[model samples]
Target: MSNLAIPKNKRVIGQRELVALTAFMMSLQALAIDAMLPALDEMARELGVAEGNQRQLVVAVFLLSSGVGALLPGSFADRFGRRSVAMFCITSYALLSLVIALIHDFTLLLVIRALQGVLSAGLMVLPATIIRDRYEGDQMARLLSLVGAVFIVVPVLAPSLGQAVLTFAGWRWIFVVLAAMAGMAGFWAWKRLPETLDPLDRQMIELPVVMRNMTHALLNRSAIGYVLGTSLLIGAVFGYVNSSQQLIGEHFGMGTWFPIVFGGTAAMMVLSNLVNSRIVERFGARRVSHTGVLAFIAVSALQVLAAFRHDGDIVYFLPLMATNLALLGFLGANFGSIAMQPFAHIAGAASSIQSFFRTFGAAVVGLFIGQSYDGTARPFAIALLICSVLALLLVLYSEKGRLFRRLNAPAKPETKPGGVY
Candidate 1:
């Protein structure tokens, strides 16, 4: 007798709808962060923040809590279901926003924001698990890259939108906007988003099984390597986000125009991911992502050199930053899909662990980078190089001493990108 496999009963939907839905779900976290950015200065002023740098805590604390908060949702999604946990997260996130709008004290606001990050994680982490449940291989990478196209829209518009809200209304309205984004996404999800995890694929809520899954995910070299590598890259992004206002507004005097400059750079990333979606099948994730990493390193070095020379103005800095950001757009989707490739059986736990490391570890390093800001781009530039180098080293480890080699051959077996031993 020969054994073959059977496909699970999945609720089929068009690819465009899935991409749009997943992109909206993933954008919830970005909306939470970016939508408040333009209001940070006024927020600091009203909240009585003592130092200029301390203003960054507005973004930092939420991300820290988000990292810690992500540890559980993946397991919950595994045991309960993806849609329920996501809806719960959206509701909790909206409620917390309501609280944040009413709070007057800075300390209390930070605490609530952290809690919201914990609850909002379902919107952040579950999308990855949902994608993993539905697709694998190059198809998964391609879908994720398309999803990135949608994800990039929030950053491009959020700062400007927040500024518009702050222009006439109170800063509190910004949180209201964040809440609105969540509510809209939640409503759409409720109406249209089908449950992706099949009954057979669901994991039992058992202590022993949780331990086994965690151990397996951590011990896998390729998975951990990808997790660590992506963490550094993500940290670079967080670092920039943390210090962007100070760099662009305070240092460069692009205060009101910060949104246009920031949005323009972000739009470049949107275009890059769109291009990646088309070419990823021909080049494979490793080839495309590795090339982006190399490009990132070169840009980082150039950024550092330009910073020291003082030879260039926005002409020099803008293009380098745009190029670096575009390359990052290339890395995020491919790296994530590659890392999650191995953990189909425990996709939720795996997604959680990977996100925990990527989110928390990057936040820690990003905090340091943000704090290191001193009216110079040197710190940001150095952090970028360090992150890129470390990520490349991990990529080498994940590849078992190989670089840019073809990972999948359908007919002939090979050790897979995220495959567990």
Candidate 2:
């Protein structure tokens, strides 16, 4: 059923063009993180990193910084317009990647990575606002799934691409490619993408206004629940991303084939999104995604048992991990759509808050799981199970105990306590 609530008069952008641009913009986050996976160990050694787990700080710190930086994008996007904000972010991202290439010190490199992540917030957080600006309900969910399917190709290709680059150049050259890609994306946005936020809807970027918006998001029951649930799942994905090289390459002895195996597994997420796009319109985002979350929990729990029985043998471990990761496609796009639904009028702020909390949650939980790595997949398996269950509970709370049922309509978020703004 079409969402009757979607305004009939919204400006139309070509679906193909919109999807491609938004997906490309969103893929920056995936590319920045995934492309470096194969090179982490080599980079770690060259940079004098002793602990393998600490290498994850490169990933975790970036995510953490991006989440924090997300606090800035929404209001600014509301004030200055989405296109301008995105351009600044893409340009900064390109320049920082160059700076990272020049930095020889590991600590300084990490600090630069963190800063790059902050700039990355515009790309990561604003896509949802752009989409919400144009669509609502299942239409919104379906579009997001399609864009995610496209965005996911980055993670799918990045490992192998990184390896290929590693063959020809050192890891530092990876930053060169990142810089070049961002430059291209910035150019694309500047030339082709039109501003989606209407001038009438723009808000002044003010401290009091931001605080009120933030408070409304936190107090809104459904939005906050979905945000919390999504955060747990993000944490699980981050934990896996942070440790996949160690588990597959170092632990399973895949060494040279690490990229292939990792790429193949990440491809499952792409497949999941494709499947989601096909079914969500008919089944409803809630039913399809709720079922997906349940399946994720069950699969994660089974993986824990498999780790116990198989003792982290790659044959049993890798497939289980891949299967669990695939389920993420279902939960992520839907959870994000649901969480942002109540804030359609303030999409930028809503997107920023959701991304900030989710990324923050992912970083903290991922660091804990990564630091627990002990030459095995057990810690990772257990972490997935725990995160999945917590996410399920949060979903239940968000849905008011309903699972697999289609929601009647989107709930309007409760306004801030004050009559202000």
lDDT of each: 0.80, 0.82
lDDT of model 2 at residue 129?
85
What TM-score should be assigned to candidate 2?
0.86
Estimate TM-scores for all models. 0.86, 0.86
User: Which segments of candidate 1 are over 4 A away from where they belong?
Assistant: 1-11, 40-58, 102-108, 245-258, 309-312, 409-421
lDDT value, candidate 1, whole model? 0.80
Q: Write the per-residue lDDT of candidate 2 for residues 302-375, one digit (tens) a residue.
A: 88898788874788887877888788888788888888877755678778888888877877888788888898
Worst 10 residues of 2 by lDDT: 1-10
Give me the displacement of residue 247 in model 1, in angstroms.
4.0
Superposed by TM-score, candidate 2 places the C-alpha of residue 376 at a distance from the truth, in angstroms, of: 4.9
Per-residue lDDT tens digits for candidate 1, residues 294-379, read 88999999988888786326677888988998998789889888888777767788888888888878878888899999887778
